[model samples]
Target: MLLHLPEGGRVVHEEHAPITLPKGWFRVIRQREYVPGSVRIVAD
Candidate 1:
């Protein structure tokens, strides 16, 4: 899905880009390890 924003508006802001995994979960690249199931919250 994609969303377009024009200028600005009242809203909460967050961003994420992840690589899909075979386990039906995804992971974001970072310097350190990511605890298991952590992505689930972000997915929600």
Candidate 2:
């Protein structure tokens, strides 16, 4: 999975050591441009 940021930065989830997501850092999109099950990291 490739995590794309708003600032154009990207985090690639390689086969080894995928990122352990923090709590309350993901957004669930039911509909829209974003794909289902795709997570967008929320900025604090």
Candidate 3:
């Protein structure tokens, strides 16, 4: 099942760029400078 935050919001589709989700105006982490394969998920 897919989970959606804020229930509903606006979505902007762009051909030259990625689709932007305006819901809640949450900031997305675009990119980080680091060594390759350093990203990982940890359970709390």
Candidate 4:
């Protein structure tokens, strides 16, 4: 997904600490895992 932070912001996840970001465009990528037949986002 594409994210745009005009005035900057913070990202928080349950398994990770809050990440501070500068004002800019960013790409959000999910962690992927490979299964027997396909690849998918890693589950926590």
Number of the predicted model whose TM-score against the real structure is largest: 4
Models ranked on lDDT: 4, 3, 2, 1
lDDT by residue (tens digit), candidate 1, 1-44: 32333432333335655433233223343344457765332332
lDDT of 1: 0.38
Higher lDDT: candidate 1 or 3? 3
Q: Candidate 3: what lDDT?
A: 0.48
Q: Per-residue CA lDDT of candidate 4, range 1-44, in tens?
A: 99999999998999899999999999988999999999999977
Which ten-residue region of model 3 has the weakest summed lDDT?
Answer: 22-31
Better of 3 and 4 by TM-score: 4
Candidates' C-alpha lDDT? 0.38, 0.45, 0.48, 0.94
TM-score of each: 0.19, 0.21, 0.20, 0.71
Q: How much is 5 displaced in model 2, in angstroms?
A: 19
Tens-place lDDT per residue, model 3, 1-44, is: 24355744554545454554544435544444555768544322
Question: How close is each model in CA RMSD to the real structure?
Answer: 12.8, 12.7, 9.4, 1.6
Off by over 4 Å in 1: 9-44
Residue 1, model 1: Cα distance from true site in angstroms? 0.3
* Residue 6 lDDT in candidate 1: 43
**CA displacement after TM-score superposition, residue 5 of candidate 3 (Å):** 13
Q: Candidate 3: which stretches are off by over 4 Å?
A: 1-17, 20-22, 35-44
